[model samples]
Target: MKCTEVNRLLNPYIDGELDLQNVLAVEAHLQECPRCNAAIAGIQTMRTAISRACEPAKAPLRLREAVQAQFAGTAAPRQATSLSLGVCLAAAPGIAALLIVGWLALAQPWNAQSNAGTAQGTRIVYHLAGGNHVKANLRTLKNHLDAEPNLQVVVVAHSDGINFLLQGAKDTEGQPYIGALRELRARGVEFRVCTNTLTRQQIDTRAVVPEAVLVPSGIAEISRLQKREGYTYLRL
Candidate 1:
């Protein structure tokens, strides 16, 4: 199978839900592809970290009682019935949809943890995926740098977030945003624009400002910074 096809099957493969044919295909692809193997490892690592971080806690007695009372008046089903094969098949799509949503929600790069006591000296990755908060996030980033001159900051921009990093982009005051970007760059802040976004949006790499570096994928870069480089994640 192709890498793209393998990618779509990864979660189900990991969950042991793939059919025998698909499972064999994905396994064959994985054996020859280091990138996909790395992706699987990353997913497993994030799952482990989230599991450890989100240990279940007992609900307070009052809250539990209140929840129970709210459901007390609900009538139980009159009969317990076994689901037919056709009904189960029909619900499979819905179950798959929920699985995809749940995986997306939980499979964040920031959920993974690096080794403890590594003393990485406060590295941070700021993620920007929308245009709405570009100016506000820039101000906040500047304030952070001003407050902590020693901070190691990296800004990863994708989607409409790449607007501020484009050539001749303007701020709310009609001033060139590149000037502010240059100032931040001078202050040791690294800006990364996603090439995937550029390709998808049909934008030339030359359109990106000199102050920003183009990365293959913004989300992948964020994941690398958080997992491999031990950078804290801040989404804005």
Candidate 2:
């Protein structure tokens, strides 16, 4: 092997990482090669000097004094090696940890109690399955609106319930119910009509209730509100 190639193996030999065969090959080159031998000796000397200089720290009197002062609530006298803001950030992981813990401690209860009762009030969903019992549910919804006045109500009309909300439809007085529904909506009661039933009955979107927004499916929409968004469901 050339001197350059022989010199390359000297450090790995000191560290003892090479295989026995490669070590013998390098040794064989080194025995006859004076130039490679001197290079290996120089490397060994440098390695010894580096290893000796890099030693474990011995705490000095000044270091002990600073540590004692910090524990005793006295100021740590600033030094040239005083922690930079970046070092403070890296060294003091507990500071950020404490802040996160504090934020969670303060935030949990307030957020947990948010759905207890709204200042404006709760939202009630009137689930109506139409046919003969439609009248009873309509009256129940009307009665609640008359009683509370402030509570927000949503009438999710699907199937046969759409007939009662049509223009000139009576609310037990031969008076048109559409105007009353519109007026209730103005007072914060919303009417959400099921578009799926409309399609089943061959009724156009323009046919029933101007205030109603057509949802894809009545059951799916009700389930979404009740499960996902925390709205209370009442079957009328």
Q: Which candidate comes out best when scored by TM-score?
A: 1
| lDDT (C-alpha) at residue 78 in model 2 | 26
Tens-place lDDT per residue, model 1, 131-218, is 7545656776777777666778899999988999999999877887877788899999999999999999999999999889999988
TM-score of each: 0.51, 0.46
In candidate 2, list every pair of residues with a backbone clash. Answer: none
Best by lDDT: 1
State, as a TM-score between 0 and 1, how close model 1 is to the true structure. Answer: 0.51
Q: Relative to the unseen true structure, what is the C-alpha lDDT of residue 76 in candidate 1, on a scale of 0 to 100? A: 34
lDDT of 2 by residue, 92-197 (tens): 3534343232223222213433362245665555565464344444555566667666667777777876666554467554566676576667878777778888
Which 10 consecutive residues of model 2 have the lowest summed lDDT?
74-83
